[model samples]
Structure formats: structure tokens, C-alpha cells
Target: MEEVIENKFIAIKSHINGAPIEFDFEVKTETISLSAKSKEVIVKNLYVSIDPYQLHRMKSCSSSQTTIYLAAPVQPGQSIDTYGVGRVVASGRPDFAKDDLVVGLLAWGEYTVVEEGRLLNKLDPMGLPLPYHVGPLGFSGLTAYAGFFEICKPKKGENVFVSAASGSVGSLVGQYAKLFGCHVVGCAGSQKKVDLLKEKLGFDDAFNYKDETDLNSALKRYFPNGIDIYFDNVGGEMLEAAVANMNKFGRVALCGVISEYTGGGKRPALEMLDVVYKRITIQGFLAADHTKNYGDFISTITDHLRTGKMQALCDISHGLESIPSAFVGLFRGDNIGKKIVQIAHE
Candidate 1:
């Protein structure tokens, strides 16, 4: 007789229009047999990532307006899905077997049944921390790498700036720019994050955006000669200021606009005259579009990690029930680096 296992997962109470709250998610349980169908696998989730972009998946949208990059919106009663690292407990697929550690798109649940098409990639851990796969070595890391190199096209000794500088992707962007021989400056919401950027991440300079009364002046103070490359994570006023202070032929890698993700607000108006006069190039890129560079990114970043050239930081929450708060914290800037939930221990 097949034994039944009770699985707990998170589901949206309803589609949200503004910022998500703790009440938006609900924990539910279902019983499943410890068996997988052909071409499917049952996984026990270990670590799940809580990223700002996941908010897009929680909104309700019409068919024509439902175009979201990389993910689709979650239905009211359906379980929410995100990238995670898991251990396979049961597999009906020939390639995957029991106890196989994998990293891929799994739901915010204790156990998940995944079909072949949903798997993103398998993991080897490789003497690194398991959570590192979901942090520096995972999607966020890839995002920082591709957005900086492919989009920004940075040059040695260039003046670089990153917004939301202590978060997962932005933190790495700052460090990468420094290692590339650029003068890196970053902005974060709090003094602690500023310290992390300057002292820990090796950013040339960093400041608390919350303390700045005039963002344009603040940027000018840091980039006296004008910014040559801007890795934009929190758009809006920061982007406007960056544009106003960018050097001619500058590059803007539009990685994310976390500011607009929650709380309905008018889009920040930019002075196009500056954009035209400066000849700045702004490009929005999705990391999924640059999977071809994953191998190169892994090889290069791994070497940096092995040596002391780069650092990866993770802010982890324990247990499945902590998923809601952990996820909501990203928008509030409550986390220092990568915000993740640890569902179980290896």
C-alpha cells in the first residue's frame, strides 16, 4: 500500500492590485501518495526565493494585458510558484531519481509535484552551500551578470552606479563593477545596507537614498564627472536622477523597477532633453533571455567566489509559514541581501 503524505503550500487569497500583505497568502494542505506519475517527480522543497518580480504574478490581468516576462499570474485558489532548490523524494522520470538534489521552478510549498517541462535546471551543490544555488549561483546571480555585462557594456575605469545596491542582484552588480576596475557607487534604503555596500561588498562609495533630500544632487556628489554606467533596480526618481547625471554615451541596464511594483503611483517623469543631449542608451533585459551565457557566468563567478574576489549574501527565513512575511519583506526593503525561505534542512 502506498503511504500518504500531507503537503502544505501557499495560495493567494485573492488577486491583489497594490502592495501585498501577509494576509494575501494562505497556507493549505493536501494529502498525496508517495508516488510520481511517468515524466513527473515529487520533490521536498528546501529553499525558495522571494524576489520582487514575483509580485507581478500575484496580480489579476486581462488576457491582452497578461504579458509578464518569465512568469504568469497566479489564480486565486492555486498555489504560488517560484524558483527553489529541492530534493527529489519520488520520481517517475528516467533521468531523475530519489534523493537527487535539483534547483528549478517549484511552488511555495513543503512538497511539489513537477512535470518535465517545468524544471529549470538540476543542481550539483559542488562544495558550496545549498542555498547559494538560489542566491548568487541561481537566477538572481544570472540576472546581475547578464544585466551588467550584456546590457551595460561597462568599460574599465568607468563610473558605475547601482540602485537598491544591497539587495541580491544589485549587491552583486556593485561588486562586479568594482572587480571590473570601475568606480562603483550604490544607493540603498537604509544605513545598514549602505555599510554593507561600502564595507562588505567593496563598492567605492554608497549612500542611504532615504536620507537624501535631493536625489539629483546626491548623485552628482558621488559621480562628480557623471555616471558612465547605471544598473537600475529601483526605477522612478532614482532613474530620473541617473539620467540627469549620466555622461554622454552612457549605458543604463534596466534590470527592475521595484518602486512601481507596489502601491499605485504615477510613473516618474524624466527630462528627455537630458537623455537626448547625453546620448544615453537604456535597455531593459530579462535574465531568461540570456541563458546562453549561464555556463560562462557560472565558471567566472565560481572562480571569484572560490577566491575572495566576490561575496554572496543571503537573508533566510525558516519554515514554510514564514514564506508570506519573507516575500512581503522584499518590497519593504526589510532584507539585506537575498530574501529566501528555508522550508527544510538537508
Candidate 2:
């Protein structure tokens, strides 16, 4: 017998400009008609990631139009776009069954209906923590791995710098550089994050960027020999400073610019002539473009995380209702690590 469900949903009421988002809660009716379709799975969402990259997409841009060709845009009255982990409650696919766990793109809702191509491989929570799929083993870890090793091409004993150093990707990039035998330095907004970077994450040294108005002076003081590689997470005045202090032949991996996501702002004037004079290379990357290498990224990070060689920090909000607040927190610098919303208690 097929079941008809009246599902409660939390949707984005409208685009927001500040620290909190507007949401519309509604009930929608869905039937089991999807079961007739092959390779279809219906799941109950458990956790959703609150990431900075989503903010970049919220703004109006030509690139945004191209990126979400397959997905629906967030209309004035709609659910926000979010990636989450869910457990299959019903499956019409041979590969999945009742109670199967998977991680992939989903809306900020209690339940979702996914057809072929949207579903990801099943995950074993025993191999990794469930939320890690939202953090390390998922997007954050892969972003750090691909950005640091693939883009920056870090060398042993090189001097490495990471901005936003205590967040998900920045923290991993710093530690990954340390693991590669590099002299790693990092910058954070708070003393607590700075302390965590230095003492817990194995950063060689760290400082609070909030306290330093002159980023150039700060970089010069920290890297007296100049930075060999810069894993940039915040692209603004700090990026300008890092560029000014880059060593000859330095490499930079542009990961994310959380600082400029909220307001369409201009970065401080960069000395591009310096790039030519020093022969510096700066490259920007989206993690999805490097998905083919994700298996390698997962294996390596899983080992590190399992062995306690690497650590992931998170600022988790309690419910699906809190998704808006969690997303907004990223812009306010209120979250200490990866911002995640727990849709339902495990």
C-alpha cells in the first residue's frame, strides 16, 4: 500500500541582508507516486551544513546563473538550498533500502524526494562521524585538501599562511601543511580561535586579525622570511597584505572569501606588478570541479581523523528551524568552526 504524507517544511521567505534569514513554514502534500519511478529514494534529513559559499550564491551574479543550471533558485517564498545527510525511509532503488544512510544535496526540510543523480553513495557512520560528512569527510575537508595540496602544491619546510585559520577549511589547511613539514602560520578573528590554532591544531604561530589594523605590518612581523604559500580563505584587505609579503615564486590557493560575501565590496588594491616581479601564482577553485579526487581525499582525511592526527571543530545549531540563524552566523563570525544545523536528534 502506498502512503500519502503531509510534510511540514521550512522555506526561505526572502533573501536577507544581515545576520539572520527569513523563513516561511508551510505544509505540503506528497504522494508515493515517486515510488513508481526507478532509482528514486525518499529520505528524512538529519543535518544540514551552514556554509559561507552558499552566501556567495545568494547575491545576484552571472556566475550564479550558470552554477545552478539544474537546481531551482530560492524564490521569495521557498526553501533555502542546503546539503545534508539523510536516512532513507523508503526506497524504490535497488542500491538503497529502508534505513540506508546517504549524504548529498538536499533542501532545508524534514523530508525530501530525490530521483537519480541527486543521491550520493551510502555512508557508514562507523567509518566516520555522521556530522563529519557535513564537515571534514564532506565538503570542508575536501576543500582544504584540494586547495592546499592540489592548488598550492605545498612543499616540505616551506612557510605557509592561512587566513580564517580556525574555521573548517583553514584549520585543516594549516594542519595539513604542518603534516607536510611546512612552517605553518594562521590568523583568526578572536584570541580563542588563535589559541586553538596554535595549541591544538599544530600551527607554528597564530594571531588575532581583529587586533591588527595594519595587516602588512602583521604579516611582515609574523613571516620575516616571507610566505612561500598562502591558503586564502578570506579575500579582502588580508589577501592584499598576504600578496604584498609573498615570497618569490609563492603559490596562493583562493579557497573562499567569507569577508566579502555579505556585501558586494571591493578588495583593497592589489599590487599585480608584484605578482609579475615575484612570479607569484594565484588560482581559484570550486571543490565540485575536483570531485574525481574525493575518494583519495576521504581516505586520507578519514585516517587522520580516526587516528586523532586531525581534528574537526563544529558550532552546531539545534534544529531545522535554526537553519536560518546558523547560516546568518557565518557572516557575523559567530561560529568557531564548521557551522552545522541538526535537523533531528540522532
Candidate 3:
């Protein structure tokens, strides 16, 4: 007789419109029959990344609208959507086998059965940190690399500004700009993050956005000459201020607009006249669109990682049970770097 292991999962119990996530715990069987196992692999999840973008998808948006579908809404009572690293426990497929490590989309559970497309290329866990696959070398790293080099064509001696600068992607953006000889200025919500950006992350200048009552004045004070590149993460009022202070032919990488992700009410609007007057180019992008360049990105970033040229900071929460709180912390700006959940390995 084939041996089976019991599994436990945490799933969303209901849809939340404008608040912290709600979840329910359930126990279930880990393995399926032969036919089901043939198409899918059962994996023991190791770590889950807590990202601000996930909060945007947790809400139930009407599918009837075509103009606004940033992310697919999570079905009520289903497993929450996230990227995780796992070890394959059982596999009927030839490409993967038991004990193989993988990183890709996975449910927020101890064990999960998933079809193949979401799985990433098998990784060699030796000589590398596991959390880097989730942080600097993972999704956040890709976003920062692509946003800076691809979307925003930075020149030497350019003045660059990044919002939410101590978070996952922002810290890297600032560093990359500095490497290219651009003067980097960053804004964070708290004083601690500001210190991390300037003292630790090597930003030329940084400030607590929360402390600045007049955002436009703050931008002027920081970049009296005007910003040449803007890496926008928190969009809304700060974006508007960035636009008002941009130089001629400035570029803006619209990586994420976390400001509009929550609450059912009206989203904040931006003033677009600056795009015309300043000849500013603002482009929105997703990491999925840049997979072709992953090899190139990994080569450059990994080299930096090996040398002391680049550094990564991670804010990890322990256990699968802390998933909801880890996610909630992103909104409250409770995390210093990348927010991640560490599931125990048995």
C-alpha cells in the first residue's frame, strides 16, 4: 500500500473589500489518486513572499470591466495566491522528482498539488541563500533591474528619485542608480527606513515622506535642479509631486501604485500636464513581460551579490499561520525590507 501524509491549509474564508485579510484553517489529505498525481506534483512549501501587490488582488473586482483588470481576484474560500519555494515530495512527471527544490506559484499551505506551468526551473540550493530566491534575486530584484535599466534609460550624473525606497524593490533601484553614477534620492514612510536608505543602502540623499507636509517643497529641497528619473512605487500624491518637479526629457518607471490598492472608494487622481511640459515618459510594466531578460538580469545581479557591490535586506515572519499578519504589515509599513513568511521544514 502507498503511504500518505496528512496536510493542513489556510484559505480565504470570504472576500474583503477594504481591510486586512481574513482566513480559515482546514485539514485535508496530502496525496491524490494515480491519475491526479500524474498531472500534478505534491510539494511541501518552505517560504512564502508577502508583497504589497498581493493586497490589490485580494479584493473582488467585477470581471465585466475590461479597462481595469490589474490582477485576477481570489475566489472566496479558495487558497490565497502567492509565490513560494517548495520541495517536491511526490511527482509522477519525469522532469521533476522527489526532493527536487522549486520556486513558483503555490498555495498558503503545508502541502499542495499544482500543475506544472507555474513551477520555475529547478534550482541548486548549494552556495546560495534560500531567501535570496524570494527577495533580491527573485521577483523584487527582477522588478528593480528591469525598471531601472529597461524602462528608465538612466544617464551618468542624472538625478534619480525613488519612493518607498527602503522596501523590496526601491532599495535596489536606488543602488543601481548610484552604480550608474546618478545622484539618488529616496523617500520612506518612517525615519528608520530613511536611515537605512541613506546610511545602509547608499542613497545620496533620503527623507521621511511622512515628515514632509508639503511634498512638492520636499522634492524641490532635495533636488533643487529637478529630478531626471523617478521610480514610482507609491503613486497618488507623491507621484503628482514628482511630476511637478521633473526635468525636461525625464523618465518614470511605473512599477506599482500601492496607494490605490485599498478601500472601495475613489482612487486618487494625477495631474498629467507635466508629461507634456516636461516631455516626461511614464511606462507601466510587469515582471512577467521581462522574463526573456532573466538570464541577463541574474548574471549581473548575482555578480554584484557575490562581490560586496550589492546587498539585500529581508523581513521574514515565521510560520504559515503568520501569513495574514505578514501581508497586513506591508500596508502599515511595518517591514523594513522584503516581507516574507518562513514555513517550517520537517
**Model 2, position 210: C-alpha lDDT score:** 86
**What tens-digit string does per-residue lDDT give for candidate 2 at 1-346?**
6556644456545454543444423333333443525778887788888887665445434255466442334554455556778888878789988888888876677777787887466878866668888988777888899999899998899999999998888988998999989999999988989999988998999999989979999999999999999999999898899999999999989988767666654575789998999999999987777888888998898888889998888778887667766766677677887888888766
lDDT of each prediction vs. the true structure?
0.89, 0.79, 0.80
Q: What's the TM-score of every candidate structure?
A: 0.97, 0.92, 0.92
- Those runs of model 1 whose alpha carbons end farther than 4 Å from true positions after fitting are 62-65
Count of backbone collisions in candidate 2: 0
Window of ten residues with lowest summed lDDT in model 1: 61-70
Model 3, 247-332: lDDT tens digits are: 99999999987776675323535567778877899899887778887999888888887887878888888887787777777877
Which has the greatest lDDT? 1
Query: What lDDT would candidate 3 get against the real structure?
Result: 0.80
Candidate 3 wrongly placed segments (more than 4 Å): 21-36, 62-70, 264-269
User: Candidate 1 on 45-144: residue-level lDDT in tens?
Assistant: 9999998887777778634235643567778878777889999999998888899999998889999889878854568888889888999998999999
Residue pairs with backbone overlap in model 1: none
